[model samples]
Target: MVKFNVTRKETSPIDGQKPGTSGLRKKVKVFKQPNYLQNFVQSTFNALTPEKVKGATLVVSGDGRYYSKDAIQIIIKMAAANGVRRVWVGQHGLLSTPAVSAVIRERVGADGSKATGAFILTASHNPGGPHEDFGIKYNMENGGPAPEGITDKIFENTKTIKEYLVAEDLPDVDISTIGVTSFGGAEGQFDVDVFDSASDYVKLMKSIFDFESIKKLLSSPKFTFCYDALHGVAGAYAKRIFVEELGAPESSLLNCVPKEDFGGGHPDPNLTYAKELVARMGLGKTPSQDEPPEFGAAADGDADRNMVLGKRFFVTPSDSVAIIAANAVESIPYFSSGLKGVARFDIVLLRSMPTSAALDVVAKHLNLKFFEVPTGWKFFGNLMDAGLCSVCGEESFGTGSDHIREKDGIWAVLAWLSILAYKNKENLNGDQLVTVEDIVRKHWETYGRHYYTRYDYENVDAGAAKELMAHLVKLQSSIPDVNKLVKEIHSDVSNVASADEFEYKDPVDGSISKHQGIRYLFEDGSRLVS
Candidate 1:
């Protein structure tokens, strides 16, 4: 047996290591700095409970971004040195954020070990390359991003971190293969296991949805489908699930090959970023010679965000979740009789503060528990852990349920497909199938519609942005002043009935998150947030 020695390398804290809701993200050059990644990784291990590190299993993988291979090797060595009994890596160092979560929760090692945490490396929807962005975030045993309490500890540890542990003599394990490599160490034995990236996630998906029904819908001549992975990590699973398992035509997949640079395009699954998919769906600037498919979808870099589309139509994320929540009980079998045996009217739905009130309307009509949480997914994770939320989404193209703690892009696509299958169960051979647009229109007709739009001002000076937020908060002191300002902007605009800085109190944890954003409630059901 080969033996490896651990070395404690002396290091100093680097400035600007603070992590946001997603973890540390920066340009590849920034992460390439000496000890930069090491510092953050060490800080994360320090923030976790000692039991979670020593003699525990951890998974390390991410979207096949530019530096992901190197990051995976580094994290493996670090995990071994930190006394982690085993480290799991997805084959070829590829795993979507949601896949990592699923692996952590569902995958068992050959040695019968379960992962307690994971280091997910990807900048999500952000662009990636040598000069673009890179990121590393830690997920807990529950398969969710670390809560604020743990992240706060990580940031503090990063500030004062003086050293990191690594097994410098440990040869890099080949992450391209699916097998286990073991080594003897001072603590006992450290192992690195490389496994298939999609099996666990696919198995989970199969259990939640009726693939035969979705496959039947796909096989129907009247129901055409197209999916674009945007050359991101979603491509890794798209072929297995959508094509091999669900029986979609091979040609229906676009950019189904994962690329480190996302094929030199931004991997955000929106109308602007997913240009090729939009064009194929008949929503682009130039029309195609052939008719568009009945349904289309795209995924971001890490496959945690999704955009749903129909022929020449886009489904807003806010409306997507509401429609899913409204129909989940009937369409998805898991919602009707899985997990907590969730039933109609027993479902709980949630939306981020910035998301429109579309989901709230569904909740009211169904008499389901509803909550408006801050933008972070951790808030929803808390509710799901407490069995308080069954479905949740954000306006930023994220959607999921208690099936997994993290938002799941492919799962969202599968869910929409399930709904379509259920709606057309008896009509697959009819002259025309029920389209995505039809379902959305029916939802609006039943629950009324809420129009939502957002404008972003990026790269603003920090001080100016702070001042602007302060100004918005300050105006909330006087409702009349806000109303007057609204009227001044546009006489036809509705008057502001009330205003306040958004604050959320976690029902499960009783943690208060203040100043999530500034919101103005209108006389009608409309709302404006900043």
Candidate 2:
């Protein structure tokens, strides 16, 4: 139709725009404004120097959500204008969060001969559609999401972006093809390559995990396992790895197909959204319930989140991390060579503050360093880079090591399989085996469960949420008066550890995040209000 070239102009909104925990996420309508996405994309391009853009190869992919394909076209044009030469896009614009990280690290590299990084368009587990939220995030050459320093620079550039350049209206290239196509006025220049999305990522997984061992485990007739992809991108990966590669029965996988709208359901792999899986595990053979049948594991949208269950048993993410850490050498090949040889006790195992103290026990037992950081996977990246830790996790269904930079749901599931296989090799019976639930139960029996329950007052007015947090903080400060009532319920309630609003300073850049959440810890091992 029509072709045009555009350039950035100094603009108010383009100056100093910040990205939150994931990216600049707001309501879907916020991104629908004319030239809204263009402005941000231009600002991002302007943030980088020509040296950073010229001849650089960038990996581009998204969660296969609505608006993702359109955004990819815009990015391709913008990249060409910014001097980017080659771009590697996932087939069908589908890439899990961890897969994006893997591609950036494995494909992108120095010398500019390979893809150097990527721009991931996803709001993560957040709902996605024309009417839902959309987002864009940049990953650095290391395959990790841009640290605060880089993101801040991008934001700074956004605030003062004068203009953004782009080809007027380049013909849309067929993303289904695994080849390069050029945009902009010049032919055979400004190329974007549609790469096999699952190829590079699957290779990375095979390298990190012991697929043979897991396959052996899956082959055993006595052992039974299930996997649910939650209608996210992992369906393909799961089917390939679990069914095709490992020969696990296809029936073992549920919802093992990706859907643009996640089959009209929330794709979060938490107790709330994955109720079907939980219910199946809880009620064996009860056809009365309309719940989907039980599965051993469930993955969330984008396949970065996971929930593990075993018939009537649930595993908290805290216990999962601790268990994996405690058994890493035996279960995961990456660590089997003896972590002591590669890293020192500086190996800090970290977890979110709200997570149970189970990892603390593991760290103490193993004599490894441990840290309790604010909730958010980003907090662990610094410790991992410092060699101060090898692994970290959060109470939310997130777990990962220094392997890539994000929580890998499938990786965690494979870890469980490896652990189970090792136990089976030791002649442990299914009943005698230490499932995630058993580990958590034992942890609680020793440390006592926190009786934790998170109240997420969703959609509450921002002002009201703040007021509620303030009230909680004030109540924590006046705990002495409330101690009498608290003691009546639990007489052994000991000294209340200092209570205050939780704040975090990024260990890498020292950017402070205030009021991450509120926390109350008691000497008796009970915690409240996070």
Candidate 3:
């Protein structure tokens, strides 16, 4: 009999385990403590009402990072204990963030047992290893992360969870096998089905994209591209989509195998962490050993973030979203299939405040509806659900739309390919080529660029950070005034139109976060001090 051993409960050592901009993240050591994962999992189960838990269909998967497999097993046991009837887990515990979202939307419906939600094990672009960080996030029925209200309830329950229930003894089932594994004392009763992680997602992508056109672009003699998977979960998807489906040579992909620890490399697709891809794009020799490939791309762990580069040029995520929205009709088949004919509203776009204003120009030219929300994808969920927005993005290398609740890294890459195909169709070729860098330059030329940079101060004493923010707030409120010794310089030159700590209230639910971040907006185009 598989019985859960009772463990001593200590005062919750994780007071600040609240989810971050994406999800709850902390060092591996922190989550490895006995009953740490259990408390959180139980709290998650508690967040769901009895009706939401009993006989519910749940989706489960992870990024294949350190402790992912172990976490999946524990969650399976807990879900069964919580009276969940069926669970759709990724084969071998491998599913990218976007893939999980795709599964929830495709599998969860009225006819079948609606997918109550999902529990994804990932720390996103954060480093993964024995010593690095790990995380867990719960997505709601809408395939988006649990809103602030739900997360706060989970945190509150964690503080006092005395025990967690589980099946007495169940046979370990094969995760790769696509069949049911019985649980509980009754024979052939509660069960779980291990599903292929990439099948449904690939099918959806095929429906939305013109794979034949992309295949032609991939096979073109004039085009040469490289896709680096960073040894993350996307390796399988990339191999299937880029190699098997698109007919690209197997060698076109680098790091095309999933590893538990990402092979000692930080699986983040950025200039700092994805230096290998950057170096290859800048210096790798072509088939002639004299010229480099024309394009290169990379996706982060969980495959929800992408970085695009062309030869020696880098494309910012803000610019990427704008360009894709502008070319959506030509590149993506979903938008092109007369859907625009009915609505005719220029691609609706939304972005976080800190993101570059490049999209404003595209929105103005195309007469599209544009919105600026706080720095989190959850804020876009309301607009998308209300049918007011179709495309949205964040400056942190994230982009997605109503297609999926989370950012779709491979989708974005394919979107770029479609745009390239459209550019090739047009004969308006000039010195201003259709490269990743060209997209930014064109956007800047049209809409004066907003010089943007973020300074991240990590692990600062929480009290000190709070105090500093309070001082800034006081200064902003008392305009044109200063302390006895200190004089206010440039007061009139830079009028602080607004200065306050940021808070986000969920439109769907009235949950509120008092202090998300600090902001000081200036009248001049430039703003400072976060």
Which candidate wins on TM-score? 1
> How much does candidate 2 score in TM-score?
0.89
Better of 1 and 3 by lDDT: 1
- Give the candidate order by descending TM-score: 1, 2, 3
Count of residue pairs whose backbone atoms collide, per candidate: 0, 24, 3
Predicted candidate 1 versus true structure: per-residue lDDT over 90-177, tens digit per residue: 9999999999989988988776889999999999999888999999999999999999999999999999999999999999898888
Which digits, one per residue and each the tens of the lDDT, describe model 2 over residues 1-530?
23335454334563224787676776567766666777787766666666668878888887776778888988888787677877788888888888888887776433346666788888777776667767788876767777666677778866766667776566676897877675554423577788777877778878878788778777765666778777888886888788887889998888877777777777888777776666666633444353332228988777878887765777778778887888787677888664766464656788888887778888888778777777666677766666666777877788888888778898888888887777666544344444555555765676445444555566779898778777778887677865766788888778676677888776756778777778777777667855
Model 3 quality (TM-score): 0.89
* Candidate number with the higher TM-score (1 or 2): 1
Cα lDDT listed for each candidate: 0.92, 0.74, 0.76
Provide the lowest-lDDT 10-residue window in model 3.
1-10
- The candidate scoring highest on lDDT is 1
- What does the lDDT read for residue 291 in candidate 2? 34
- What's the TM-score of each model vs. the native? 0.98, 0.89, 0.89
Each model's Cα RMSD: 1.4, 3.6, 4.0
